[model samples]
Target: MPHCVILYTPNIEPKTDLGALCRKLADTMLTVRDEAGKQVFPTGGVRVLAYPAAHYAVADGKGDYAFVYLNVRMGAGRSAAVQKAAGDRLMEVAKEHFAPIFEQAPIGITLQIDESPGQVYDGKHSSLHPLFNK
Candidate 1:
């Protein structure tokens, strides 16, 4: 399972389309595959969500600043290279989505991929997994 969460400043909403960004991310996740060409992420296990930050500070609490933080969480056992590739793809989408805001004001875009340890990560997603034939 891969859950992509987008947290952005409220000011960016007027210029950025969070819904579109989320859909793009989900699509990108669906494309990730291992060396054998098998999909790395399950189709039914992908979730994309966006949240608007009402109160925040960018750098020393300046004016007209926007920030976009993408946190992607998934199950453990993927190679470093594969993780990097996924992140790079997601970042490309993010940059394209926020290009307008980048030109207009000071915008900070960041992305982080976190893989939960298999020992501590307990998951129960049978329903969706079967639907996707995963």
Candidate 2:
């Protein structure tokens, strides 16, 4: 299971569309899955969530900042060891796709798999929680 999360602080602009960014990132994630032959989240499994940084007082008062969290759930068939292996693959894809976006503004971006115990898959399923919530 491969999942991705993308969060960013955009440069000062007339309008900041976090939704667009989320969609772009999601699309990038899909590409990564295709290229890597790795399942990020599950087939037909993708979710995009966005939150204004101001909601959490992140990056000053400018809500232009955003947090994007993605979760990919693979199922319980894969063992924890295999899940982690898959996660590593997905991480590589995330870094490649996200690096350019982060370089543009140098905003806080975090992408990783969710290894937390309470995650949707955890040990029961092969899931990746790559989050970029900055």
C-alpha lDDT values of all predictions:
0.87, 0.48
Q: lDDT tens string, model 1, 106-125?
A: 99999999998856646574
Among all candidates shown, the one with the greatest lDDT: 1
TM-score of each: 0.91, 0.41
Tens-place lDDT per residue, model 2, 1-134, is 33444443334222345566556656655543333465444434455555443434455755545333345444344556656665565555545545555555433434545544445534423234333311
- Determine the C-alpha RMSD for candidate 1 after optimal superposition of all C-alphas: 1.6
- TM-score of predicted model 1? 0.91
